[model samples]
Target: MTAHFVDLLDDLRRRSLRMAQLVEEVVREACEAVFQADVEKAKRVVQRDNDVDAEEVEVESEVIRLLALYQPVGSDLRLLCTVLKVNNDLERIADCAVNVAERARHVDARTLAGPYEDLRQMGPIVVHMLHNAVKAYGSQVVDDAQRVLLEEDAVDALYGQIIRRLVAEASASPAKIAAFLDVLSVAKNLERIADHATNIAEDVVFVCTGEIVRHRMH
Candidate 1:
């Protein structure tokens, strides 16, 4: 690779990493705001989503520029493509965080039955997947990408349990029905964030191995 090509690739890598960091922060903060019932923090998460969207646009533009300018082939080409896909995924994850924060902001006075332990559990799992998927992309680690994929089932299982418990609780409590439903919606958003993270991990795998394993693996 020419010096110019290497420099361009490095720029793409750095920008993608920055975007990942911002998205992960938004997700974490949104979860915390929900748990703490901090309306101000939730508002911040909502407001910061625009910045994540802007970052996605910037990453997409950079990827296209690299494609046009350097015409990267093989691994370089795959990395650029994965960056484009993963950029979209990260932006969508941020949008999910915003949705969760929005739900938190309008919560009624009635207390949510018990703590949101399951939602809390899902948060770190998704965050770790986001971190590992991005790290794998940065280092071109195909195995790490696959590991992220394997972790998605756990998120899905947790989501299922959350749904069942919330349904039962909401059905039992007529008074706190609305609050329970809001909590359920928030959990759904968190689950979707994990789904988006998994999508990015799959893109990373393709970027590294040239294999689209989306449908092949359950």
Candidate 2:
């Protein structure tokens, strides 16, 4: 690759990382909105989704442009591919945050105390997962990515617990089904965010080790 191309690639990677940081903040705000019942925080998260969406497109375009113009091979190609995949995942993560914030706008956090507590626990785990995933991406470290993978099962388990509790609670209090569904929505989005974080980690592993570990059990 030419020096100019390499410089462009580095710039694109840095841009993607900035986007990742922005998405992380959005997730944190969304979590605060839901757990603390902060409507203004939720609104901020929603507004920031627009920026994430636009950056996703720009990153994707630059990735494609580099591939077409430079025809990068080996690690360069892998890095480009990983950037594209991570870009998509980051955008989806922002969308998931928006979903959580939207649910927060309706539900009363105090009323969701018992059953929704699992979601509270799940939020930090998901955020930590994404943080590790983004760190792995930036550092291109297999170990950091592996750590993110390890956290996925915990998030999944908590999500399942929340689902079961919501089901039981809904059956007992049918009139409060709307609130239960709101909690379910938040849980589902958080679970999806965890899944995206896992995808990012898998991409990091692939980029570093050239291992296709996607479908294989870690």
Candidate 3:
């Protein structure tokens, strides 16, 4: 490939990274809206999801253009594919963050703060998982990506604990059923975000090692 292609690839990679930064900020604000009961933040998150969706289309268009025009081989090809997959996962994660934000508008984290400690804890852990996954995508480091794989277990465990507690306690405080379901929705979306982050991490490993580790024993 020519130096021109290299320059194009670099620019596309940077564009994707900027999109990642935007998605990360949206997720963080969604979590903040949940804990802080800030309806304004929740609204901002929804607005940014549109931005993410548009960026997703643009990034994908650029990838297709590069593949068609340059037909890169070897590492360049892998990196482009990784950027495309990561872009998709980032978009989905942004959608999940929007889901959480919508829930935040209705149910403040404080309402369920006492009994559902695990629900609150899941937010930051999921965010950290996403942060690390995005870091791995940017760094293309297997070690960083592997660290994200390790985190899924904690998130799954916390999700299970939250569900169990919600079930056990909902009947006791019948009046708070609405709050319980809100907590459930938040936890469910957080778990989904973790899953998406893990997917991004796996793609990063694929980029670095060229090994498809999707269903492998992590």
Best by TM-score: 2
Question: By TM-score, how accurate is candidate 2?
Answer: 0.98
TM-scores, all models, native as reference: 0.90, 0.98, 0.96
Per-residue lDDT of model 1, residues 93-183, tens digit only: 9999998888767664234334567777887887788778777767777788888888989999988988888778778888888777787
The parts of candidate 2 lying over 4 Å away from their true place are none
Error of 3 at 110 (Å): 2.6
Off by over 4 Å in 3: none
Top candidate by lDDT: 2
Q: Pick the winner on lDDT between candidates 1 and 3.
A: 3
Model 2: how far residue 120 lies from native, Å: 0.8
lDDT (tens digit, per residue) of candidate 3 on 1-218: 49999999999999998999899899999999887888999999999999999999999999999999999999999999999998988999999999999987789657758777778889899989989988888888899999999999999999999999888989789998988889888999999999999999999898888999999878
Report RMSD (Å) for each prediction in the order shown: 2.2, 0.9, 1.2
Worst 10 residues of 2 by lDDT: 111-120
| Order of the predicted models by TM-score, top scorer first | 2, 3, 1
- Candidate 3 lDDT at 186 equals 90
- Write down the RMSD of candidate 2 (Cα, Å): 0.9
Clashing pairs in 2: none
